[model samples]
Target: MSKLIDPIASVEDDTKSPVSVPSSPKDSPRTPIVALKHKHEDKPLSRSSSLLDMLHLKDVHIPTPPAVKFAPLNVPRHRRLQTAVVATWAFMIPICLTVFYGSLIFSKWLRPLAVAYAIWFVLFDRAWVHRGGRRQEWIRRSAFWKNFAAYYPITTVKEADLPADGKYVFGYHPHGIISMGAACTFATESTGFSELFPGVVCHLLTLDANFWIPFYRDILMGMGLSSVSKRSCRSILKMGRSICIVIGGASESLYAYPGTNDLTLKKRLGFIKIAIREGASLVPVYGFGENDIYELLPNEKGTMTYRFQKWFQSTFGFTVPLFHGRSVFTYNYGLMPYRRPVTVVVGSPIAVKQIDKPTDEEVQAVHKEYIEALQALWDKYKDKYAKDRKSELKLVD
Candidate 1:
């Protein structure tokens, strides 16, 4: 075997060099020199070192950091499957777009079908806008979604059983970066939503702009997502079907920092008004650990970043947040969300009486009750699920 060397000893040896000693104390310099000459003179200069040398920084010695640790090739099959499923869901939009365009371009037979679909989507396809989009039970019950949910291992906790006879409105809170919890829990049946509340079908509401995408829109509609517009919500409620809405929307996503539960719900009265008008019971669903999966950059109010985000939202009706998560091969950083357990708790329903036209006072009264119900839900489960939470829930505008 080769001889072993101590790193500390090697560093000491490399640093040590011969220094000339003076015979008299008066001839010696005030400060003793550790190394009078450059020690790396004999070694060939690296490209970075040469550039630094040209800048008269020959004496500078920058330490090199250790390389990032990546997942080994011998990872478990289940783990690989989980990563693959999550990656597919994460990049589904671009993948769908590419496939849609590529098929039309490469295959001559698909162009006619593509043109007809485009015309219908632009002119007459109001399923996403009216009647809660066509939901295919087969697609909603696909095994693929189970694998996707298993990646985050998302679970749904039903506090009380909602009767099928009652129409309901679920207000999903603290919109996480991409509302992963909301999507997995409501948009898909991966979390056993159907079994938990039998006969109570839920259509998750999203922005109207999302339906503009070609192939991606079909996937969303198939998953039982509809537009969040006033008309769509009213229409869905009229049909006696329940709907789930992420109350915070894009504004709340900006404040989606880990361990924080700040919600932008102070002035949100539209959902409350609609519920009152349609006699839909309001259910507050909180997804504990929703904001913990991704790390978001600080863009506090009054800052340039925050101002710009607000401006962009005003201009485009949506805002893009600067956030990051772990990658498939590494835990340090990428678009893939960290493997964090997200528990979505569906709370008790708050009853509302139907009104022809709810006044401001009536709306405010219902809004207060809704807020209290949501707060109670948070207080009840924060200790159990949010033990690592940095702060209590706050309803910020």
Candidate 2:
């Protein structure tokens, strides 16, 4: 049986001695990859040479890490105890709440509501701020979500018959709190999005407040994401072929708990108008399991959380999505909710004719078309994605 030996001990040669072998053109030969031997020399081979011989490979030595980079391992004696204390306290709230209400919140409807509370925040609960960090960098490649994929697993399905020829405006609906899956797949190319939709460049839009911050602003930019403003929409649609907006804004996220699909878009018509103005086709995408992943504290339409979010929005130009998910400790449950599989299904395209400044009648006409398109997508995929859905799609003001 071959036991694993520490290579460090055997290769700890302080001084690298010269051992002559097939040489460079100026000496003996060029190199193993591209070489012609001229002569050889006699010298003592080190243990590294023996290892190379066993591996049947030429010696292409690499240096060790610089010594100045590492300091002696020194940690406080109470460090482990401190970590244990912090972890216990962090898990205390969930444990208490689990024993208290986890049993009481069991009804079909009640259970869903509890689930909602777990995934959401009550306006003031977002732990971090989106300071408009780097977006373009995240959008490019090798992003945080790519690394995070190992934990928060997600899959993207883009199947709409998109024209490989023109620009498009994709309107994603029912933005569950933070729309984590959509944000990951659309905003970052890490989700294998580009490979799914060839020839199409997608830009996901977020709130302008996200861009107001320093680090977050760059993060957002690196992801090719921008504000969901008219200026942003118009510029993006005008710029190229693909841009997406989480059609259901903050209000949508608030109502995103499973079994209760309430949308606040009856009065929202800006996206439709932009579609008309830009003449880009409309593609509706719905992410199943988006709401099931997190249970949040209740924030009904008239609740304090809801009101606070509106106030925050009016004051700062953007509202915070009060949300939660699996805690760092628990794997199956917590304030953050469970890790559920989210499947985003892309629907057929709704072709639109571009207009510079459409009149009220023109906008309304396009709006009707948009509704049909949205309805078509819902009707086609409702059963496939929303197997346990409680009700049919509704268009309420």
Candidate 3:
């Protein structure tokens, strides 16, 4: 079982005040110290007194309770705007649904338009499935994404330049809580990915289920995000554009505890097969401080919580993790992730030979090489970016 360290109690200390005694103790037999009496010490305890106080536990030192720090009213407008954009992004799915359904219900005149749109979405919407989504360069370069990236202050570090002519598959590691780093870096232009790696147009790939949401689907497509289905990947690579996949997927998200880099990669060979078959260069991207944005509840393996979460993922396509972060109003607890810096370091691409039908051994060989590159990347940046990590980078199945 994994142990969870208390972030609050780690910084607290117990102090003892020195008591002065008479100098005569050196020459004479030690005399028992008499308690100094105060007039109030003899007074009867009130009803409001705690049990410890009533029991005369006067020597006990009680630590002050932890208090939530609320956001100050004088916060800068730009910072507030950043928070608003982040909050909107966080709750975007529900917000879109509400807007869609609310418009149909409240605005009676728009019902026919809504029906038309729904029919078109159901029958003709292949944007999410093919050609790497309806990628709007202007939307990807919007100021909105810049603020979104500033929420975590996400940055992209390019170790080697990727050529424009080559097709590439970016394997994003450690699938941190929502893969926020991946979304900000690849889905949007928040991280200046285009400038960092000029000429390489990248699309962030997500689950097919995400495209099922009405308005949210359009928003995701507009930001250059596509479905992670094999067909979608092939279509994108065929067009000579690259795609970034959170290789760990939903299963890895269960291990997203703060300060840990436990990735589910040993048995993940699908991305490797895709890379080899499509003849795309494999790039390993690690997001440092990705898991430190939120604290997860104890759901270690063998526990019911862990079992249920695993069962849900196996039964459905995703699982819910019990996590908490600071709120918009207060800094103690809420759904808003902590404003931690996420530095996404893009490692040098490993060129793969195009194989029509790769054997298991060949796939494993490529997978091994990819793992080494990812590990080397971690080793290089762990000290500088992941100094606070609790454990070294681990590739857990």
Candidate 4:
């Protein structure tokens, strides 16, 4: 081996150049000074060029966000009428509740009666849990849901005609903020759900807490929306009514970003268990443009916002999505969801065997088939319906 040189000595040798140094004190003589050659001195660069090179600069393509096109300022009379009908729908529930509560406050006698009614509704009036609530075809075919569905101009296409006698548990994907497509297709006759499958009445399941609201519960019940609870699901399935479940729930609403198909379903097996337990056929329904309707705040993983949202879910049993969309006049900025086409596609049904207590392996087997069906639905329509998507379907946890 060659003799080792001291690092300090080598450094000193590198800076051994001498130059004359002027003395600061006028009385002192000039002294000899030492300077070092910079390591990159051979390659001379201008100040700006050197700074740019240090940054390792490269051209970045920042794509322009797509512009939201609104209906013409001078809308036709029919379209204006349609808008009014939609607005009425948006305000109907709130108006009814306000009037009901106002009556309770204004009338002293009504307070005690109202309190009694509430107690009865909470304790004994579980009538909302039955298939009878869903058989109200008159309400399901009403003008309100008709107008609401017509606002989006929603449509449904079945891969194959479902058997009228078969019981189904439809696992609706993406949750889509409020699951507008689920409401339009399953809860109402706007998309002609009845005509598509003649004798099968599909009840859209929601959180049991929704039925706690006074007038709103009646409205939901009238539209045949029952609780998403296991008991409610089993009861409905046993009664021969199909159940449409928003599988992603509130957690998936966090992933409802525009142009992205981020679903929170990889680890969800509760629906599969229910399907197997009730012997309900598992139907995978995908709503294209459901996530694209509203633009939500980015809740990236490990960020405080996402952590807080997850905590909120654990505490409150639901999540709040920070989302915004267009307004009546403006093209892009309001509470109203942007007028995007939401196509609810119903895929082929996966048959499940009824088991009193399904084993882990049995549940997983059904879940795998359900996931594959959902993926197939996505793959089939992604190009046709989601041509402007930013990314392909991501099965997020």
Look at candidate 1 and give me any clashing residue pairs: none
Candidate 2: residue 276 Cα off by (Å): 1.6
- After TM-score superposition, the amount by which residue 120's alpha carbon in candidate 3 deviates from its true location, in angstroms, is 1.0
Mind sharing the TM-score for model 2?
A: 0.61
| Candidate 4 Cα RMSD (Å) | 11.7
Clashing pairs in 3: none
TM-score of 3: 0.83
Task: Give the per-residue Cα lDDT of candidate 1 at 19.
Answer: 52
> lDDT tens digits, residues 305-370, model 1?
999999999999999899988788887668899889899999999999999799999999999999
lDDT of each: 0.87, 0.62, 0.86, 0.80
What would the TM-scores of all predictions be?
A: 0.83, 0.61, 0.83, 0.79
Better of 3 and 4 by lDDT: 3
Off by over 4 Å in 3: 1-66
Worst 10 residues of 1 by lDDT: 4-13
Q: Could you say which candidate leads in TM-score?
A: 3
TM-score of decoy 1 = 0.83
lDDT of 4: 0.80
Candidate 4 local lDDT, 97-155, one digit each (tens): 77668767888878887778778888977865755353577889987777777777778
Clashes of each: 0, 50, 0, 0
